[model samples]
Target: MKKVLFASTALIATAGVAAAEVNFSGYGRFGIGYVEDRSETTIVRGPGADGLNGTADDVLARSTAQTDDVILVSRFRLNIDGIAETDGGVRFEGRVRLQADEDASNGEANSAGLNGARFSVIYGGLRVDAGNVAGSFDNLANYYGNEVGLELFAGQYSGVDYNFLAYSSTGSGANAVFFQYSVGDFSFGASYDQAQATVIGAGGTTSTTVDADRWDISATYTFNNITAAVAYGQTDAGVAGVSDPSLTVLTLGGEWGDFSGTLFVADDATQVASTDGTAWGLSAAYNLGAATTLLFTYGDGNASADTQQVAIGAIYDLGGGASLRGGIGRNDCDSCASDTIVADFGAQFNF
Candidate 1:
């Protein structure tokens, strides 16, 4: 449920004083875990001939395949929203979030993990946001639904990883403008980001960076106890030797009694030559009692990068703004040719 909060002072319609309400909120989790994957090359190259780094031939290289790491991990987020209405009834809303850094390694707080800010204007069912916002695909079921084992099967998207459209508002760092409108049981949203990904080319010891942009649109319908949504996105390859990237996702979600689940299918094409990505995933939840719930999630990806994952978790409400979380899962990917084995037990706090 969305929370609406009032400002400390309730002054309204006064001399030059605007009536504004501020809402403060966020969620966090902490746990111990281990992960590893090394089926495919996890390396990225800079100034390397193989179009990859960290190999035997690269000057600077990095890879995501990790065999092991520290087990202690934590996440934190904070959001402050300012809202006010003009005398003519136009609504103005601004948000600043203190979220985790997207590229940060484990157990690090550089500059207190501050993300960016965004603002929105709303009139009736229409709303728009600018500055540090994400695209419409962020609201997809597999992206937004309950996830377990530290977001093994869900969470990050691999197919469309080049731009803000792939990450949405939650993906740490891409900034954009977002638009949305709602009428009764139907709603639509769109977003655009300039230079979300930069084209890079090695010029001897020099590298070239080109500017590009991306955009996405999504629509959703709610009927009875079900909601269905579709999102499409495209990214312009700002430089030569690159193909324009595009993605499409379809999702169906519903609740029958205490059982709720989401089924989603996605297809992605990026600027990389001769490469394709397709995925299907499902997530479900059931309440076991007043304060306990069970969750399950699974995902399978096709193409050169065949991947699959499944997880089951349980959440126990502990009252007073906290809950107990536990999950176990396994994931394997072909392109990177790696496997992730996971078991996570933690506590989450919401405000």
Candidate 2:
């Protein structure tokens, strides 16, 4: 098992009779993994690979890995959360990610950067946010219930990675603006992103960044152990030749007794680098006895090539915010000619 150290500090200060609280928190995970047959076939990049019929044979030209792949999977995140209240009943909240262990092109560390930072100003039940804000569609569903031992291997299904609106270029982190409203058990949110305000083409030449804007809206309802959410969004590819891209996502999640899970689906448009259709997934987590839990996930990408993936994993609690985790999975293309085998064994902890 791996080991992790955690710490927290709280501070309260007064500025003109208005008090504020600042808290520090972070989490880290590490593990070992082995992967087979990994590629960027359907992933949406600039344009896309040629002959994208969603078939493996069609995309045989894709860059495939060299047989069995071994890797070390690890990540560390540190965030500072701050809250301040005004005498007028308004509030301000912000979060800043202080360090990223590995986010470089060559898998090196970034020296004290702010990768997942965001800030918000609030009044009544409405709030506005900016900087590294999450998109409404993705904020609602980051594959809520999926579980895997080694993210470098099986990881999340391809559907979660390419939500049309959640493209690889700007989905993870982007410069954006967002609005949110909360009332009792219901909440609503909307986001607009200018993630690529300056576009540099293949040759590092400058191009107009007007067409890179994107927007989306989402709603979530939670009552006890049951929750439901829906979101819709669109993205413009900036340069012409392809249609504008869009996505509609829905999720239903619930927990009863010792069982909990999530079901989701997505309708995608502007399938520039992926299948031109719909995708869906289901995940389940069941507690066994006192300290062990079982995890399962299944997914289907309703593309011309019929993509499907599944994973089976388990978790063993070690108390004090740590757990032993491992899983083995297989992903295959029924209509196409591609397949993958993924496995990992490791430990994770939260602080």
Give me the candidate number with maximum TM-score.
1
**Local accuracy of candidate 1 as per-residue lDDT tens digits, 1-351:** 123222213343233546667777988877765454322234445646655553345656555544334455566778878788888788988877776532223434434444567778999999988877767887554455567654333432433333445333343556678899999999999988877343344433334456667888999999999899998988777667777778888888899988998887777675454346776778889998889999887877666554567778888999998998878777666665467676767788898
Taking the tens digit of each residue's C-alpha lDDT, what string does model 2 give over 1-351? Answer: 122222222212444445687777877777766666533223323422333343222323444233326556667767788888888888888887765443312233445556555778999889888877766865675445566664533323445434423312212366678888989999998999864545544433333555667899999999898888998887777666767678777888898999988887877665554566787888888999789988888877767554677889888999999988889888776456767777877887888
- Model 2 pairs whose backbones collide: none
Clash counts per candidate, in order, are: 11, 0
Q: How close to the true structure is residue 276 of candidate 1, measured as C-alpha lDDT? A: 66
Each prediction's RMSD to truth: 5.7, 7.5
> TM-score for every candidate vs. truth?
0.79, 0.75
Model 1 worst lDDT window (10 residues):
1-10
**After TM-score superposition, what is the CA distance of residue 46 in candidate 2 from its true location, in Å?**
19
Q: Scored by Cα lDDT, where does model 1 land?
A: 0.68
Q: In angstroms, give how far residue 2 of model 2 lies from its true place.
A: 26
